[model samples]
Structure formats: C-alpha cells, structure tokens
Target: MAVAPQVLPHTAISTWSGFVYQGKLALYHCLKLMSSDYAANRDLKLQLESQDDFAIFRRQQCLSMHQVKAYKDPRFSAYSDGISTQRDNARQRGVALAYFHVAREVTNVPATFVADYGPVRFYTYPIPPDAAGNVIQSFCPLNQVDMFIRDELSSLLVNAAMQPAWKNYIVANIQNTLEAIVNLKVIMTHSKIHESTRHQTVIAASEFIEFSELYDVIEANDYAPFENEAFFLSRLQIDIGTYYQEFCERQDSLSQAACQKLDDYLAAITSLNVEGMKAFLRATMPHKKGRFKTLSEFKDQSLDRDAMRLGMFTIFWKLVQTARNDGSDVAFSWLNDGLFYYPTGIHHAAEHQESICHDIMQQAISEDVECLFECGALITSAIDRPSISDVIIGIDATEGVDTAEHELLRENRIGNYKKVAMISLNNVPESLKDAEPD
Candidate 1:
C-alpha cells in the first residue's frame, strides 16, 4: 500500500548510526528467515519456536529437540535455572530437548534434563585460535559431526524406539537437523551472500505493492515482524537460476553506486583548484636543512599566490648560506634554467600566461630586504672586503637588477663580471698580468 503524500506519516530519527544499526537488524532477521525457509525447501520444517536468542528444533518422530546458541564471548557460565525451565517446558510440551552453544566453554548439562531427554552437544567455531588465542569448545569439529550425531542418536534409539522403521525415521530426522545446522553456519560465515539473497527476497515480495503498506498490513494483523518471510521463500523458488544471475547483476550495480556516492561526498568537501594549489606548494617548498632562526619562523605565512615567491626567496637564502659556509662562491651558470632563475621576457614572448617568474622574484626581493642584506654580508666575508668603489657601484647595480624584465640574463652576466673582478682584486696571474691592462 503506497502512502498518500498529503497524510502525515510515522516519524523517525535521520542519522547514519541509526541506518547502520537498522540495516544490521534487517540482515539478522533476513538470515534467520533464509535458514528456516531453506530447511523447509529441503522437506524439513525447523520452526522459529523460541523468543530468546536460540534456535529450537525438533524433527518428525524425533524424541529430542536441539537449542543452538551462536555468540561472541566464549566463557560459558554454569547452567542457569532459566535453561532448566526451558528444558522442563520442552518436556512438558511433549518434546525431548538438548542444547548447544557455538563457542568454546559451556556449563555441564543439568542431570535431570539429561535423564529425561538426552545429552546436550556443543557446536563451536572453527579450530584455529580466535584473535584472543582461544579455541571454541566444540563437541566435535564439523567434519566429525556426522559420526558423532549418528552414534549419539544410536544410543538414544536403543531404548527410545524398538521398531526398525521407526529407528530409521528418527535417524533420517537427525540427519535433516544436522544438515540445517551446517547450512546455518555457512550462511552466518558468508553474510554477504545471505544479505544479497534476502534483498532479492524482500524486493520480490514487494514488487506489486509498496513495502510500507505491506508492513503496515502485517503489523495490523498482529503477526510477527517479518510476516511475509514465507512470501520471499515462494519468490526464491521460482527460477532460482534466474534469481542468482539477477543477484550478480544487482551486486555489480551496488558496487558502482557505492563508488559514485563516495566520489560525490569527497567532491562536496573540497574544490579542484584548492587541491591543485596545495600540490603546487608541496612540490615547491624548501625541505629540511637548518633549524629556524626564530620561533615566529615556524608558523606558516604562505597562504596565497605569494607562497611560491616566498618559497623561492627562502631557497635562495639557503643557497647563499651554504656557499658562504663552504668558503666557495656559486657560479651563475650553475643556476641556469634552474627553479630560482627568472626569465619573464622569454616567458611572455612564448605566450605562457601563468604567473611570470620576474614578477615573482621582484616581489620576493622587495619584501625580504633583511635576508638580502645578510646574504650580501656573507658574500663579502666569503671573498674579500669590498673596496669603496666596489661597495658604491655594487649597490647601484643591485637596485636596477630587480626592475629588469630579463633579470636572469642580467644576473648571470653580472655573476661572470664579479668572478673576474674577484680574481683581479686577489691575485692577478702572471699570464694575465703580462697580456694587457684592461
């Protein structure tokens, strides 16, 4: 029954955690339905006859019912009065009963229940130690279950039934019960398969009717929450081969939908350009060398387009410092076509419309005059004390260098001139001294 949009409907909290919890509950119920229905499909009915967390079952002509418990914690406490009551209830109701827990460690069966019905068995998790290094206390492994059940049933049959045909029927019923238990384990382990199968079952059940209306009808009838579980079983029976193929297709579609939703969620949080800018800054930033000169230097000041300019200035200062410490001057040719060299004239002529290198350098040089002055001091100390003429003329040249369009070309040429000047000022070689006075 489709709900009318004009009518007020039931209200519920809209939260992701709620969705997750509800989905898990739905999956649990669905698995239970599949387990029961699959047993019925095999000509055996394992009813959901218990309200507590247990699988209670009895087969045709069988003298014993089994209660199966699957749980996380493995430490089994002593048999409680509650279990004894359940056992008495089963006996009073004309059914013999036994109980088993899935994990290792279980209390001893009540002596009265054993005398009245049969021995309680334990069906545990696999043999390998779990995360906490504890093996489940199983009556026997799955491989051993067949022989174990057969032998136990034989003992029960010795006095319970004397007729051959009746004994055979009871044995067959025990086999059916074991098969159901095995199938239940398989379903629990491969939960995805159970979930997918259940989804198809629910969808098929609601094909011609709105699920909400169907749910409302079921609730109004005072039936169980999943009243239409049998409906899904009927739907699954129609062409199971087709149903499996459709299930694979639906699984593929779900994978695609999940990926697209993830992409949409990520795109909603961040812009493409912001990501690109971050990439640029990470690639260009100067890496570790020396410790910072001041605490203020530890804070990031590069947040905008000027970040690249600041990065270059810092790198240039480091280069100058390294050269001074090594007692060697760097050749201008060494920086040719390198990251620090700025050739705006050539860049502009090529119609490359990105941020110009010369402009970046001008901004960097103008803003970091203290760093430039320190570099000049280091350069002077590394070579020789500058003469009055050298100091006066060098400052005049430095002022004009930042304003030039082809700053790298001029800078490289000026480096060659400085090298020549240093050689002349220190020691004029005999060959050059004898040649001519420039």
Candidate 2:
C-alpha cells in the first residue's frame, strides 16, 4: 500500500515514499508519549522543541532531543549495529554542557520553559537484523564524567588540519554542552515488532480503526509497523488474536475462493511433518539440510506466509492474464479478491513474471495445490480496477534476475504502466471503423 508516492483509488490510502525519514520522526514522537515515564506524569503536558527534529518534554521540562536519522546505506553505521562514533557524539554533547556552564543557567530561563538537560538520542527505524536474524535495538550510554579527558580530548586533534589547542577547544565545546547534555542513546525503533509488544500495539490500534485495515493504513502511511504510537498503544489490553479474527470477518470484498485457498494453505502448512519434510528435502539439497531443518522449526512465520502468498498471487495473475487474452467467458471467480486486496494493479499484475515456473516450484515444496496458490496470489495482487494487461514489463532486463529485486523494481515500474493503461483505455476511438464503415 505504501508502495509509492500516490493515493489508492476509492480509499483513504495515500503514501509518500520519499518522506520515510520524516515519518519515522513522527513515529518517534508518538513513541515518546507512549513511554510509561511520560504517561505517568500527573500533569503530562509537553511542547515540541524544534531545535532538533523533536525534543521530548513533560510539564514544561525537556527530557530528550530525539534526532532521527535513517541510514540505509551500507557505509553508514546502522542504529541496530551500535557504533562507537554515535556514542562518542552523545558523550561530546554531555561534555559541552559542562564546559559551557549552560546547565548552571537552568533557573534563569523563562517560566514557560524548563532548563532541564536531556540526552541527545539518535533513533533509527527498521532496526537491522542481528546474526540470529532477529531485529535488535542498540543503545549506547556515553558518560561524560567517565570519559578520559586526555585520551578523548587528544583523539580530536588532526595535526594536519588544526592545532591541538584549537582542536581541544572545539572538541571541548562540542563534547560538553551548556545544556548539560546527558548520555547519548541510539535506539532501534522497530526492534519489538515480532514480540508481544507489537501484538499489543496492533490490537490497540484496531480500536481506532478497522482491524482488517489497521495494518494497511499504518503500512501505507510510512511502512512503519505502527504509524501513531499513541493511538496504537491506547488499547493494549485487548486480545490480539480475537480482534484479528473479528477484523477478518468484516473484510467485505474478499473472494470466497481466495479465503478457501488461504484456509487450505494454512492447513497444509500447519499439518506439515517437519522432520519428514526435512528428510525429504535433504535428499536433493544434501548440503542444505540445516536450512530445511531450521525452516521446519518455525511452522508459520508471518514473513514466510506473506512470501508464499505473493508466489500464489503471481501465479494466479498469470492465469487471469491468459484467460483474459483468450477471451474466456466464465466470469472471473475471484474478481472481488483481485480488485480489493492485491498490492499491484490488474494490468500490471504478474508483469515480467514466470508463473508456470513458480507453480512448479511451489508444488514441489508445498502440499497445497497450484490452483490454491494461484487463488491466493490473485487476491494479494488485486487492484481497484480491472483493465487490459499493460505492455510494459515490471523491471528492466538489465536489473538482473533476482526475484526479490524484481519485486522491488516492480513497485516503481507497475505504477507507471497502470497510468499508461488507464489513458489508453480512456482514449478509445469514437467508433470502431469496420471494413463496411466509412
């Protein structure tokens, strides 16, 4: 839903893919208010300090300055990985406060503001995965009081660039702030997504929005697991599974065929004999027995299910395209499913796809039938309107043949093709000129 910077038809679903960084900042603000410490305040009033992106406060007293920096580039240190430099910056801010004597002037400020000192923390979204493939939150506590002045101070001197005295003065001011900067912390914002806390957030958010469309809205807004922390965290006491079931029941446009396939797929996955499947897969993938074994251990991982659904959808889409081309008159069985749920437009669904190959691969590994997979895929890829297939391919041939990369490239490619297809459809000739017609 948050595939690009556009709005979905007949729905409030709109997205700004470029504003990912800004959205994270907003998420951070909501997270701060969700904190137990802030919420427990008898008079929990706060204001936004635009000095940094946002500074958290309560009762006119500032607590922390949240500087959100999204680092997707491999060269930069991700917040999940915890870097020494980020910690050092936090330490430097603390040192600067001491050196500038700004903390001492706290009481001299106006009554509208509290001169309280707080940590300058950097928050990064999409916390990187650890060796175990789990999202990890990294927090570095840099103490200004504990840092060795001689070593820390000397490290700042670049003899070729500046004199030691000047560097010392600069580093001192930067490290110690008149704000009495506290320790720096680098947090992985989405670290708890797979945990119970995330379930709680999801359940709570459903209270304000339809549970069926809650994730869709959050995902479309910024791809953050939870867009508004305050609303999502409000009803944390609800039963997540129960609410989710209720949400699913209310989804109006889903095709019965799609639902049936989903049920069968889930049943097949649940009924798998992990040990038997591992042994069976090991005969051909002798060296990768461990991979199958590990996969078997996690019976229905949401991510794996999503991927499976995508595969199913892609295959079904190809069938639909073939059927449409052949001019089959059997009205589509899952038209509603295809229209409301899928991620891509009808014309662009399965563009650049090798659906037959996927069908074979899926049949080999899954107990579920290929038709079931196709139905699932069709439902997932559904768009708002049904149109003739666009001629544009989802990705350039030069982009390489990786499936994941193709899916990524398709996000950008599919939108353009849909626009072209719509224009073509709208610009039909005034009347069909037959051989007999002038």
Candidate 3:
C-alpha cells in the first residue's frame, strides 16, 4: 500500500491574531534566510526591516531586498497585486526586488522559483532569464552552495514544528501579542481619568502585561467584560446594593471607620461613579508603598493586595452568575468588605493620599468586572512590582480561605491561576527553555 501524504494543519490568516502570527512566521523564515546568508559569507551583512516585514542588504555594494508575504490561496490577481505593491515598496526603499510568498502557484506571467520548506512551499519572484530568453527552472538555484544553505534553513523552519521548544516559542510569541492587544483595548476603553497620563500608563501597562502573566488570568476569568458593559454595570449596581444592605445589618460588628468606608463605597456604587469607587478601593486596599518600608513589609502588602484582588474578582464572578441566573434585577452591593477593612491593620498606607488623586476624572463611567480586575492587576503589576510567582501564589492561596465567599472565589481562582501559570516561563514546556529562535 502507498503511504498517504501528511497534511499540515491550516492556520487561519483572517483574524487579527492570525494575521500577526502569519507576519511573525514570515519574519522567522526571513531571519533564517538572513542567518544562512551570513553563514555563507560573513561579509554579506543582511538586516530585516520589521515594520515592513522585508529583508534588505548590501551585496557587492548593490542594495538587494526581499519582501515576504504568506497567503492561504493561490489567487493570481491577489498574488500579482502583492508582487506589484512589494516591488513598488522595494523601489521606494532603493533596493532590487525578490518577493517571497509562502503560497505555491504555477503561473506563466512572472519569473518564479519554488522551493519546499517542510510542508510549506515558498515561491520567490523575479528569477532572471538566461541569454537564450529561457526562464530558470523552478527550485533551481543559480548557485549550488547558496541553494544548500537555503535548504538547510528551510529544513530548520520545517523542523521547528517537530521540535517542542520552537513550537513553544512561536506559540508564546503569538499569545503574548494577542494578550497585549487585549490589554490595550481593555485599558483604553475603561480608563477615563487623566487622558495623557492614562495613555502613558496604558502603554507602560500593556508592555508589562504583554510579557507578564497577570493579564492572562484577568483575561481568562472574563474579569474585563468589555462586551457586556451595560449588563455588568447593572449587575454591579445590584450587587453593591445587596452588599450595602448586608453591611448595614452587620454594622454593629464592624468598626466605625470601616462602616464609614462601606458607606462611601455604597454611595459611589449607587451613583455609578467609577472615580469614587476607585477611591474607595484605593483607600481600603493595603498595597501602597511607604517610606522606611522593609522588604518583608512590601512583600506582605503585595501578597495581601493580590489576595484581595482575587477575592474581589471572585465576588464579581458570583454577581455575574447571579445576573445570568434569573436575570436578577434586584440591586445589591458587590465589593467585599471582608477582603479589606479600612484605616486599621492596613500596611504601607498612602502618605500623600490627596496628592495621588488625578484632577481629570471621568464624568460618566461604564465598567464591567474585567475593567475593574484589569485596573487592579495593572496597578499591582506596574506599581507594586511583585515577583510573578509571588503574585500567582498570593492569588492562588485564596483557594484555602475558610469563608464561603473565599470558597466561591477559590473555585474560579484555581482555574484562572492555572491558565496564567501555564504561560509563565517556569511553567512553560521544558522544550521552550532550550528553544532559540533564528
């Protein structure tokens, strides 16, 4: 019996993430080509233009460049258009044209060279004709030594699929890019205070979150529900009311300052004032840095903040379920006072609380659980600067809290924690540790 040809999995290039992955894959291929070229002749210094996804280099004092594209289909018109555009771009960049595409197509119009790289076929354009007006044969390199290097690099790209380490590197990069985009969108949409500052903060937070594991947990847990803005606000309003009523019932057991803080939170939630809510949380939360603070003090405060945020997320998730479950229109407060008691037992208290406030605040705020969760996570990750493992551990430890609320929080926390933990460098596939990209 004849063996069947193996079919490689088709990756969609339509979605934003897919498009980015395709670009990165193309870059990876180009990088391999550059490395191979360097190995052949160290004098040939090749540089890749990341912005345009093209390789440009000075060969024998003449500029030569290759633009790369990955296409799923062999549409002649699309291919022709891409070639023309890339040629134009190369001309503008002052370089010779050698366009590369991942797709394989047998067309009569252009001088093309085809080479197979594992399961994928790469087509290079503008292969010069011979003196007799005959085109160079496909897969036939003008130079045998250059072809050998090309084959080697191509094999490496193909082998990347077979190697766990290379696979992890590719997957991690794609995931990190997608996460950064998600984080930026979340921060941009929800942040209403201090436009310039917020923009800068969002950029910084996004850069940090792109590589960090915190946003993964926030994203996975649906803590930033940008899509369900109205529903989330309504549910949050209801949960806040419920929390306020509960607080009143237990006012006798709580301290005067704690009760006052709850009253402030109640007022903020009732009015749908995000700044006020932020203030309430900031004042109550114990994650601020203080003068003359010890290393132990910082770590303890960070752990406490992480736990409280995790617990808060747990409460938020419960409220979301409640909203989904009978379409509960009843108003109840959602913020858990159990997570943080104000003015007492709070470490690293804000020294200049009034100075910390931003003058430019959102007049009207629309927020979901995700936005709330993202804000806290960003603040902790960017400002607190806790170790990734410490943050994960702190949040994960919420699983052990004895209270019913903490139990509810713990169940969801475990899953989110696991999801984020898997992406961490220490927890990623062992092969990833050894993988070095071309």
Q: Write the per-residue lDDT of candidate 3 for residues 293-379, one digit (tens) a residue.
A: 232222233224323333332222212111111232112222222221112112222342222211101100111112122111112
Give the top-scoring candidate (lDDT): 3
Q: Tell me the lDDT of model 3 at 67.
A: 39
The Cα error of candidate 2 at residue 303, in Å, is 19
Error of 1 at 266 (Å): 26
Per-residue alpha-carbon lDDT of model 1 for 1-438, expressed as tens digits?
A: 985453111111111111111222222222333333432322322322222122233233223333333222334444344355545545554554444433225445545654543444343333458788976545432233345445444543443323244445455443333333333322222232223433433322211111223123212323233223222221211112122222222332333333233222212211112223222222222121222232122222322223222222222222211111122122110121221221010112213212222222333333321222212211110122221122223233355444555577456434532332111111322321212111
Worst 10 residues of 1 by lDDT: 338-347
Query: Residue 406 deviation, candidate 2, in Å?
Result: 47
* Residue 75 of model 1, lDDT score: 40
- Model 3 global lDDT (CA atoms, 0 to 1): 0.31
Indicate the TM-score of model 1.
0.21
Q: What lDDT would each prediction earn against the true structure?
A: 0.29, 0.27, 0.31
**How much is 267 displaced in model 3, in angstroms?**
36
Q: In candidate 2, what are the lDDT values of residues 1-438, reduced to their tens digit?
A: 455452111111011111122222333333323333322532432222122223343443334433333222323223222323323333543322111111011122223221222232223222358788866333211111113232322342333223335445444333222111110010111111212332533321221111123112212323233322222211110111122223333444445454443333222222223333332222211111122224323222212222323333332322222111123221122233242112211222334234422322332233221122222222223222232123233324224448877766555434422331111112222221111211
> Arrange candidates by TM-score, highest first: which order?
3, 2, 1
The C-alpha TM-scores of every prediction are 0.21, 0.22, 0.27
